[model samples]
Target chain A: MILLDDGCPDFAGEMGEKTGIDFNRCLQCKTCANGCPFIDGMDQAPNRIIRMIQFGMAEEVLKTSTIWVCVGCNTCSSACPMAIDIPALMDGLRHAALDRGVEIPEPDILNFHQEVLNTVKKYGRTHKLEIMMRYKLKKMDLFSDMGVGLKMLKKRKLDLTPSRVKDMKAIEKIFQEP
Target chain B: MKRSSRNLDPGPSSGKLKFSFFPGCSLKASGHENTLSLLKFCQSMDIDLVELEDWNCCGSSSAHSIDKRSAKYLPMRNLSLAPRGVPLLIACPSCLLRLKSSFLSIKADPALRRDYEDFFEKPFDDELEIIHFFEIFNRVDLKDHMEILAGTLKGIRVAPYYGCMLFMPPDLRYEKSHTGIIEKSLKSLGADIVSYGYANRCCGTYLSVAKPDIARKVVNEIIFKAMEAGAECLVTACSMCHLNLEIRCTLDNPIPVLHFSELLSMALGAEDHKKWFPRHIVDPVPLLKKRGLLA
Candidate 1:
């Protein structure tokens, strides 16, 4: 029920840390995992994570790489017989873990997501160069993608200067607001 | 939601053919040509396009990825603002899905529907139907009108690219069968149409910023698929798809990407092809010139 509510924007009148979670209805079907193409890379498949939640194994659920790897593609949500919005729950779980300052299974992946957010927050949209600079400055090895980036730059596909949306502060407010 | 008289204003025009235009962010930004050409076509076709007032972004697939309700509400606010009982013409597939998904969910829940009504200035009557601009173009008899362009694009072959957004989530209801019609439209303008496997491939969308490495890999696949299928040029209905596949890629095997409108506009000789064509990261200018259409 909480998952359904959180997924529906009409009920977002009051924002809170508990974005919402509805875990009671999962039937232990492996369909979400079976249907997921990214399942092989995940430590806990969607079904196993749901089972972990059902078993009150919050620590296991929170710590697993499953939440980070979730593409939020709605494949799991679509395949779930219970029609559980597993993608949204996974997003919620990710936020839950982040709020608690838990280290992600792959720090680089989390850093990448955060880099995007920071870029968008700063310029309202990202420029390839700015993103690369931030990534390299934060951790050096990320510059390895530059071989490809330089090639694209020569072709004028990757602009060195980042573009900004007009009134970026308003755009920033949209992201910063609850 | 209380239905106010202002929200009930039957809009500036009335007929069996009226559509509220929801130009997604791309249309306002880089994809402005698609929107302009679409409006021009609508004008020529006598279809009244009512623009929604004070509309914000539909949040595209981003808001939905982070929060489902934000996705629904983001689109719902726009849907509620539209004139009731008119089919909404969506240019962006992402926006169409966001609106349609919210609409379907609202009908399934009474409390939520009622709560939505209370929040909006006008009560949403569940009367708004989402339709794509492409659907309108193909459904209407534009054959005679398109025939005028038969001599314009003499020898260019276009592969119609739908990308992933236009076909996914099962609810957008785009007729995959329209491939023939799209081909016919281009051919009517005197361009040869090619078949390609990348017609429905993913373009790494927001991931272009979110995960550049993954995005590059995904975009490479789409490009390779298009080239492998023997398409000389690629045409798309979505601006973001065009931007991603044609503009954002790091690939060397770049093909010209044309918005369906730009292609049609070129055929009509109504487009300033130089302004639009060269701006693309992968210039389609050479392709047009090859066909002697870019003199």
Candidate 2:
């Protein structure tokens, strides 16, 4: 059996303060877990996460791969009986993890996040080929996917050339703005 | 096919169907053709649109991920500006959802709503409707009329991509019915709809900029899925999705990407194929010519 308190804050109290998650009204109906598509795969289901977070397990809460696996589909939040913003809460945890500089559970997850920002930072807008090439190089097994790329090329679905917008500065500004 | 016995055209009504048009930033820049075609289609069908006076980006997948308030505020400002009676008509589903979710969050908590409303000059009442462009096309009997236009779409297998928004959270649909609105809408225009699962898959959109490796993986999955589904070309409703899928082919062949309206305008015998043809990374002219639709 799981410890009820475990040196964490009340489930309902911390949720309202930190993540804007409304756990006080949770009916414990498990509707969210049932509707959550990712629940089966999750070690701690959405409801449990809310419960754990409510108990103030901030460190342990932010250190799991569960946050990354969330597709952010909002199905759980949509189905929550208490209308708990579970998806937003998950995002909150992700941000908290980043702020604390905690080691992410998966290496690929952080790389994916960094790659996205890099592309946006570089071109103001992402160039598909550049993003793909960078990703392949970083992953260190670029040629493993080369066959698929060649096939797509043969079918004329993947274009080698990329064209940038004339007002690239405007795009840059959007990203650069504080 | 449900054939319409009477004139399906919704005759002039007493009250105009008013909605704030949020043509997300990409449409203003690279998606001009798409915006134009959508405008033309709306006009051709006698639909009224009230575009927001000075709209900006919805802060897309990146801004929100980076900072929540900043991302939510951008869409919130637009939602606050939306006309009261009609639902806000958004061309981009991602923007629609973001705005809708923000609005939903506000309504669920009055204090937060008031707090944010104060952040804006004018106080918002949270009585706005955020709708996708697809919703307007499917409202009431729009699809029935669209079916009449379907006989024109005979050739060309179009891979209709839905990206990650249009049908997520499950409640945003206009008609509340089960139908492949995108594909069926195109089919009504006489295009062969390629059946595929990737139609609703994420284009690795947020990943496109934030996580290239994952973005590449996701995009490649979309491409392979579309090809395996037998699509001659891919048609999308999202510009971001278009960007990710279009520029990735770094070889001799590239799949041509076109907005749904670009294809429809071609089939409806409206747009100039030459001008639009050269602009696309993939050549849609041959396909159009093969169908004897292009001059």
Candidate 3:
């Protein structure tokens, strides 16, 4: 019982303006959908998502797991006949979803993103062990990758100590601005 | 202003080519081998890789997904700190993509450039070249060195995995296929380059963490494709790709995955191959020993 035209706003135009990718140039050739590795899991193929955006289906586009599932591999952008920056467009949608406070379908994915940012914000560089631990705690999936984590630790690949950059205040300021 | 790869000068005419090195996060953590091998390779070639002074995170995939401005500014901070006139050489392809895209984005828009300058308190210079470490192979004449090391890599059939970031969004890519330089270098080292279908395929990246099933599927396909083409090992430039290929590979017999730099350094007679090979999830030592590349 989803109404495509009832509350659909000019999502595509705003997104295009924000990301600088002209959705109008998409040839509907399915090249992007064909090349997407996650298309099978997607509710709508990438090409269809673009078409939905073009049709101003803001709610449908925003609510779908498409944005969250996209790994930002840039395969679609490379395959696009029109050379549209589809990966950038995907990033813009993720940002827009955050701005609108849309509930991301994949909470773990959302948590992972936030955890990575929090680690970077605190240390000014990503601490692999800290980031992974925080992400697991946030997602409460502690035991899933424990074995591999232990292996990484044993190999000394995941250092326990966090790297400290000199300009902590500057990094904090950059996060504060805009 | 599109920078053509051809216009890039090959090698440093001077005694040493000095540049700031940004190893990103993975280089210090999961991809320590890449850092070790790259440093060894640089030392052998008389290249000076001064580590960037107190470099911060480039925001990577996370910042770009949540906040657009932070994504641009975080990497911009690193670019700003990079020494003027000295190109910034980055080992991770993901870092290169973030830095290069931010550079292009700011250059395309003036107000955005002003905002970055105001935030960073430093003038944004578009002239600064962000070079990927793989591109350095293209610049150096490795023919003679390869001849010297040819015996080591003889009979090693390798599949060069370019992953996705090395060539994408048209401009950031060093070359269209992005595997030519790697393949050429491996060939020069006397290794057989296997023609595989998924050479440029996505390694499912962070998706391996977010969605393991999807990641496993993609990694399996790449692995099988390489094995089908008779490759004993998979050589890649990106750290993430190396991680994904190794971690998600559910193959019955997984092939050894080595960063292209690892193989290059090993071929160049790096004394401490043992230091880096242990870092690999899929041990490459057995294959190397079998081929008599390692004693």
Candidate 4:
């Protein structure tokens, strides 16, 4: 009861070759989807994403919130009977999505990712207080986790100052390369 | 146990099992309690955990999702800095997975290895063994030590939560069975092991911060499942799992969440327990006090 799409481009093969995920081996059993914690929040389930890739539906796959929302928890990959590295494949898809300049459905998550990198780039290590402050300012939800933040501060869990690595240039170099 | 042929002794000789410790970002920050407890526990075990010189971020989930190159390169840089023979001891499961996966990726592709060397301006020898601290604990014979500490944790029912990262992608995991080492360690410490269905379940991770509603639903399920199984406390190896469960769970009567290292330290009779336990959002001391583990 499935229609053949011989004309479709081979997104699965490209992604598989890049990440060694073997998307073709996916059985459509929905095991990965069933085990996924965020399946309900995802626009397409993990298995559906794999199926879309197999059918070479790159644009649709890239446009969905599935890749953005995927936590890279590796639950799906661990449960996959095909032994497909679904988390790595998801990473590859996110890379592809960014490269293709596809619209990211989850802008806040995207912003958070960039901000984390930026925080690390600036401090060589992540300063939780600074990162949280910047993230809140960007997201404009400064009060969301303020209670927990206060608790962390009182416990001396949050370092007031940033940790600087001796070789800041080396960290900068890693960020600059490619 | 072949020592590194290289003469690079980065830290003072402790005449013990030496490892370059990569605490990752969380350990230095929100997971400070885990760091303090782990350090104290290691000191007691006589393991010399030298901090990796100029260690940078592992990029965690952010770099991996955004750029494949950064994901591999960030951890690769840390691996390159590690001494030739000493295994790298990573406390955070996220860092362990990233470092191990990156090591495997470079090993599988010579071209990628060459590119990394050229890019980092350092030799890309995949000789460094990346070992998680949990694995290190597993190797240590805690049986003798347990006898002394057994009284502290006796009769306390606990659930061991192994979260998703510690047992995933086969090659990177410490054990095939998710809770094997943890369960063994808990039993050795004289605690009642509560069998829970969601022991290896994901705690919704970063989503707990980015999307709390979704994470709360998952966190609630994990907590309720443990409580339903009669577990008085939940101990986890991953800091993110600890954070999610402690912060996100919307339970009226939430159980205490403790890092395995903290529990181990307590059993080993770590004094000034206030230093580590206070950092927890849901205080674990009340439960420990109720169990007669703490004064």
Superposed Cα deviation of residue A175, candidate 4 (Å):
1.0
CAPRI band for model 1 = incorrect
- Give me the candidate number with maximum lDDT: 3
lDDT of 1 at B10: 57
In angstroms, the error of model 2 at B51 is 2.1
**TM-scores for every predicted model:** 0.71, 0.68, 0.92, 0.92
Clashes found in each candidate (C-alpha, N, C closer than 3 A)? 6, 21, 0, 0
lDDT of 4 by residue, B214-292 (tens): 9999999999999999999999988878887887877998999999899888888888578888788888888998988
Q: Write the per-residue lDDT of candidate 2 for residues B237-284, one digit (tens) a residue.
A: 887677667655443355677887677666556664444455455667
Model 1 chain B: ten consecutive residues of lowest lDDT: B1-10
Encode model 4's per-residue lDDT on A1-178: one tens digit a residue: 2322353447866887788776657789998898888988899998898878877899999999988888877888787888877877777888899999988898878877888888788877777778778878998889987877787788766789988778888888778856
Pairs in clash, predicted candidate 4:
none
lDDT of 1 by residue, B1-295 (tens): 1123345445555433567777866665556566766666665565667776555567564454444444446667767767777677888877777777778778778987986786564676766677777777655677656666566778676788876566545443333434455677777777777776667665656555445666666667767777777777888877778777754566676777888878776666665555455456677777777878877
Tell me which of candidates 1 and 3 scores higher on lDDT: 3
Over B1-295, each residue of candidate 3 has an lDDT whose tens digit, in order, gives 1122234334557544676899899887788888888888887775677788888889988898987667878998988898788889988888988888788878888998998888778898888988888667666666646656765688799999988877675556543344588888788778899997888798988877778888899999999999999999999988878888887888897999999889888888898988898888889999999988888
Q: Is model 4 an incorrect, acceptable, medium or high docking prediction?
A: medium
